[model samples]
Target: MIKREWAGETAVIIAGGPSLTVEDAVYCQGRARAVVVNDGYRIAPFADLLYAGDAAWWDGHQGAPSFAGQKWTQSKVAALRWSLRHIQSQHAYGISDSPERIHSGQNSGFQALNLTYLLGARRILLLGFDMQPTGGSRHWFGNHPPELHRDSNYAAWRGWFDIAAKQLVCRGVEVVNCSRETALTVFPRSTIQACL
Candidate 1:
């Protein structure tokens, strides 16, 4: 089992969404533990952990050497590299309480939330989890390269989070969505400032 090293602490998950900003990343630095998902590390390099589900992302970024924190993924090929922590993947909905693996919600952001919980955070604050596109752009970084997948089935992703929310409540974990704008309403909403 993963040790509850951060028990009772608060964690902030930074995701790659249009609503994310450098200011938001700056505010999280030193304020609380952070987990950056996919390209979020570009803005929050100081994040404690980074999670990406796709192996191609790691390959394209050359293993994200700029990020000094621990890297995690469910991709076995990517995890084979010394820099990453490999958590097995389970095809299911809701959070996986077991430390050995995680439920693949088919999105890196949702998986990052489960990782934060496994790290022993009692309270989790989400930023940039906008499940919908903004200004015709799907992510803050614009779109992925032509070879990579660019489309997101946000409706399906949101459903997974809804299921995860109920599971988290049962575990006594508090989750608050602090995105400036978002379509994910499974958790209670709060402003980043209020959360900080």
Candidate 2:
């Protein structure tokens, strides 16, 4: 089970949307606790946590992510030699209130949201959660390696996020979308500087 280590603090989750920039990640350093999703660690290696769901990703990284902080995954069988915390996965939609597991929402970004909530973050900020292709690119670092799924089911993902937003509100948690450009309209928008 995860501990409420960051109780009442703000957490930032960084995704790999094309609208994301290294500057965005750099700006968040020391400002708030951060969770970098998938390859987002390349830009924000100093982030507090790294989360990925695909086992293939773990395989590609040789089961050893370069991230310095905690590395978390929903993948049941990660190809890791060292210990990696495996959080239980629930249904695909909505947020899981339980601290022991998180609803996948079929994307790392959404899962990171559930994680931050469980970690006791009262406010969560989303960066690079565009949820749609921007500037003709799916992600800031470009497409994943050939073996992994590339296309995103944006509609379904958005629906899941919408449900999660409402649930967070009911729990008195605050969520803000701080992406520079985004298709997600479920959360109130704000600039990273303003949020900090």
Candidate that scores best on TM-score: 1
Expressed as tens digits, the lDDT of each residue in 7-40 for candidate 1 is 9999999998899888987899999999999999
RMSD of 2: 1.3
Candidate-wise lDDT, in order = 0.90, 0.89
TM-score of each: 0.97, 0.96
Q: Could you give candidate 2's per-residue lDDT for residues 1-196 as a string of tens digits?
A: 8899999999999999999988888999999999999898889999999998888888887765466899889887882543678899887668998888999898889888999999999999999999999999999998988988667899889989999999999999999999999999999999888999
Q: In model 2, which regions exceed 4 Å deviation?
A: 79-82
C-alpha RMSD for every candidate: 1.0, 1.3
Q: Can you give the lDDT of residue 122 in candidate 1?
A: 96
Question: Which predicted model would earn the best lDDT?
Answer: 1
Which pairs of residues collide in candidate 2? none
